[model samples]
Target chain A: MDTNQPRWQRRKDARPAEIIEAALTLFVDKGFAATRLDDVATQAGVTKGTVYLYFANKEELFKAVVRETILPNIESGEHLLADHQGTWAELLWILLERWADRMEYSASTGISKLMIAEASNFPDLARFYVEEVVMRSRKLFATVIQRGIDAGEFRPVDPVMATRAVISPLMLIKVWKQSFSLCDTEPVDLKAFARFHYELMMQGLASR
Target chain B: MDTNQPRWQRRKDARPAEIIEAALTLFVDKGFAATRLDDVATQAGVTKGTVYLYFANKEELFKAVVRETILPNIESGEHLLADHQGTWAELLWILLERWADRMEYSASTGISKLMIAEASNFPDLARFYVEEVVMRSRKLFATVIQRGIDAGEFRPVDPVMATRAVISPLMLIKVWKQSFSLCDTEPVDLKAFARFHYELMMQGLASR
Candidate 1:
């Protein structure tokens, strides 16, 4: 809207985010292997040449989409973990609540789907995502579970397995909603489902 | 080697199955949209013309892969449900055991990954897969849960939601093994994880 500003400078600033958003939609819709970079550029309202200016290739663009959409949220999750002072159960409940609010309901959730779907095809991207996103999220859960066990607030178990059990249903439901929920008539209330899972997991983890 | 069998008759019977198997591998690797029918035909040691004799199109070949690999196992599951006379917990545990044994260590799990990855782009295939595969599997769990609730053997809970909860971790772990498990150094013991999940869920569902 700034008529006086240089067009190249304005386009340069906005294209990366705009292109990333468009690419995420395509990747989520078409999947990584099926999606074409030229189509992504077209969808983002830019030329293929223009798209190449920001990303060197399709893989780089794919990487940018994952990095741009998911990494910020992961960083904030780390911040939440560092700053939180609460019951471990409450912290987990809150952490998952934030995950649901931030990632599950948005385009970012597609990053999770894309990684799960195409990890074998793109091992390097998958490995990077694990290192950057999945492990960080697991550590958040594992740390809280460890805290709970150390504080005599929860029963002893493998913190890692406990973390997997706690998160599996949540991740399944999220992926199910995006992928298979469309074909089902009886819908599971996701918010209530999350609440119930938290309660059930807490009960299972409770110190006897 | 059955020397008595005619060559064309032998090739005719085996080619369809071989084509389906090769298609599953390609669909799992390259995804539905990117996988060419020609490559699948060649991989199966047949001409594109021969492939067309069995399947009408690439989508049909994809559907055949799913049908051949998954449908028989689902039928057996349905038969197990029909034949079972046991506690719901036992039945549920048994159902998951069969699922893990049949699906987790095989290429069939890749169908799950392909469906999730490509569902948005191919809603018809997704819907068909749901009708043919997912609903049947969910119905197996739902029926067991409903029977338990009706007989007062388990606590009252939404059978459908509870069924979703029961299958969630099993499905998640299967998909995770195919996808992210390669990157993980510390592998979760899947058998122990399944047994523990069953126990935890039964504890939650216990009426006493």
Candidate 2:
């Protein structure tokens, strides 16, 4: 490969996202306190100095990693709500399926593990996540649950609490798969778990 | 206060539990790497050297703290199941209430936070917790769910998965409260949340 463009310029263009990806992996693998920036830089295929050029510090890089990975996907929930025209139960299922699909690839899984692990120590990061991610997603699902109730598609239930009920098992399964799989001797079938949740959900929410 | 007896014997008698409690508080307050033995000692009202006498190091102390606080509670659950006779749903709700009550005051809450936060870095600790706490509890609940199906008290579903479904929300909420309350401006009404879940669960598990 010929170098028409300067090294610094090419590195700068490629580094932010690559670095964020690396940072996410390292942070998730090692607790925030234990992770070293040098490791993140090596994971990114860049120099530690290069990472500093893009991100001011480890905390800034962490915030950037989160925003880059999670926030973008999070906003789509609202749009999914707006664009979908279906039964609320169907919409709810679709949303959870979509999330599970994304979780398969996204750094949000790491972010989630990180949040549960470190939220108490890092209030600012935790607050940002709660506001930007948790509250927004809860609102999105709450709207769907409320719509379902209004349409008589679901048995009357507290939209907020019921949404959480619908969400918790799925979320917990994902988190468990990410965090505790090391100790889990048996492999979990993600598809079947989702399906079982859906079938039970159908019965649970049915207006009957 | 007069110490007629030698101080070493007095500390020997009282110190181990106090040190464990202090370690639990500090480990939860600061992530493990950030927590200092000095801080734990100060919290426990002991000397750092005294902590060493009882606990070889931080990790050992952490495990001991877990054993002291959670393992004791963990065994009682199996006993509770052995002693309980009622509807399966009724038994399930009772177990959850007992857990929630324990979570409110127990060091297990902090130990849980620590485990999730640091599990990757400390696989041995995680494995011990998974074996001693998680599996045993899962076994007890799985038995109840299976009995419900066998007796036709609840609808048919994979008892293991169904038990997980029942457990995930309650467990996640407790972990969230333990780990993320700093960022949570709106305090969760634990009782209301549990009540809503129980009602939805009644539907979810009811015989079709």
Candidate 3:
């Protein structure tokens, strides 16, 4: 042990991250209403007081967990869109694929369910998630669509509506997978699904 | 009040329906974990014993409410599909449009949130919803797609996957509207949105 290190240094910076990870797992498994802070403390292998040092209460802990886990995921998609340039269809497909991947593994789905359950009472959290995460992601997609339209890589389309068109099916697929665990029935080749969605999105439903 | 009905008839039939209706409104507003049977009775203007006479517990009341509200909505869709015929694109647009209309005002969205929150703990309810509602709806869409494929209204396509593609976007739109209330800022014209979705569903991304 490094005895000379300050007390703050002794508690590794990673401890907060680790605590959030543990909290999310518990929240997803037991739900926000049912999960106790004691359980999270035990799961994180920290004293209850130590847990309190980082979070004021269970609701605060949940909000922190959601902010830490989901916001970055959406930001990463924005980062990708900013860094990459491709055909409109290709760019949209990449974003959709990334979204599907995130929903498949992340605790965001569970957090979303918890938010939905509590939104009538906790409208603030619902509004925060929508404004901070959902709308942010939608705006990013809309920007990409507008860019594509300007470049003539895509038709002159309503970027906002087009973004919804591109993203909504993927969102539904995630809900289906979460609500039904359809992922377990068989390995859905997501690449194929992505391509299928992309094709439907760019063209009208008319025979040549 | 008309008390001419047989004692068993009112207790067995009308009372249960009333209790379930009251439960649905309470559950939609307060959520499953927070709502009490006493609240349901108060909301219905009935005695606590009247609720217990119909439902064994809160869970039973929830299930009964879900069954009563959702089953009829789904059955109505089935009836609509059975009585109508058109081009695959036309029929799908109509079905999805009707679905969007039905979900707009129904308590199903709130119930769905509750189901997702509790599904890990109550897997039976989740399974019941998936099997009873989701699978059945998917089958109906697949039947329409198959008819389209046979009639040369659509290019050769996998009806199951096509149905998923056709319906998934609409489901996502519903989640977006209900969960985030995104439509408040930019209200989606459901008819036009459904038409756009249907057109995209029938065609691929390639330029005509």
Candidate 4:
């Protein structure tokens, strides 16, 4: 709805985002191997040829979908860490809260679940994700954790290992939402779970 | 190895275990939908008919594989909790250590990975796993946590949510081993990871 730009130019710019959105949904619903570019095109209301104009193949589209949808959350989390004037524990809590909020509502959250399910069949893509997304995300966390230690706000636990402890429950929640929680008559209270986990983590990390 | 029994009788008794093992490997390798009875029989060194005699179908065979291999670990863990007179922290650490040790050496560890990947395709199987394995496993952790709380050894966190915090890293490690870690030149040290996580959890849960 940006009338400032020429209609054709605006449409051209919007197409890739639309395609990525469509592809993300399909990849999450169907495993990565089973999702086709044609299905993504149809879902995006673009022709199959249009999908190719943006992405060379399904694999590229999948990667693009991940980068466009999931990586921004990490970027913003970094921004929160950089801009905040808060206690390390409070910053960690806020970061977890923001993450849990996004995960509660985002279709992109299913990407991790999809990747876990299909990564075995696509080792190259898996490696790309581990290097690009997983490692970078862990670094973002490790940075905050290290900051906490340097400030003498936290115990000097190994930041690398502590990062795993912090993020693993979040990762599990995402996967569970897509898989087993689908079948649960009384599904997990994700908000309560996240809050409790954050409290426990901060308590453990607190310097005596 | 037992000479007290007839060789044929012993062989007949061993066939089900062999079939379960074969089915588990196939399920982890090829996934449930793609694995066939004939292939499993071949892996077990039995006829397809012999597999059929032990298990009515693929679902039954998969369930038996889970129950036969994974449940005994849980049972033994339960026994540890029941017999332990140690501090709750020590008991929790031992449970995690035992669980991690089993995961390090067991092919059945792959069952959770296989289930996570294939669960959406087989909802009934997923539901069965959640109700049987997932819930049971959580209950085992919760019981220990509750005992700790009642004995004034730990803080009063909700046992179920705390249980998720305890188990999520273990679940993430299992899935990671099957998926992303396949490409890692430097694989995780499972023992060190488990040790750090246990230390953190107990520290967090300890009452002042």
Pick the TM-score winner. 4
lDDT of 2 by residue, A1-208 (tens): 3479889787667778899888988888776877899999888998999899989998899889878888777678788888888788888778788877876776568778788887776788888888878888788888988888889888787777877888888777666766677997655676677767776776777797
TM-score, each model? 0.86, 0.88, 0.84, 0.96
Candidates 2 and 3 compared by lDDT, better number: 2
Ranking by TM-score: 4, 2, 1, 3
Tell me, what's the RMSD of every candidate? 3.4, 3.5, 4.1, 1.6
| Count of clashes in candidate 4 | 0
Candidate 1, residue A159: Cα displacement in angstroms equals 1.6
Pairs of colliding residues, candidate 3: A199-B205, A205-B199
- Residues B134-199, candidate 3: write the lDDT tens digits: 778888888877777777777776676677778876676665555556323556776677767676
- Minimum summed lDDT over a 10-residue window in model 3 chain B is located at B199-208
- lDDT, candidate 3, residue B79? 82
Lowest summed lDDT window (length 10), candidate 4 chain A: A182-191
DockQ score of each predicted structure, in the order shown: 0.58, 0.60, 0.45, 0.76
Error of 1 at A104 (Å): 5.4
Regions of candidate 2 where Cα sits further than 4 Å from its true position: A1-12, A34-42, A46-57, B1-11, B34-42, B47-53
Runs in model 1 deviating more than 4 A are A1-19, A33-64, B1-11
A best-first ranking of the candidates according to their DockQ comes to: 4, 2, 1, 3
CAPRI quality of model 2: medium
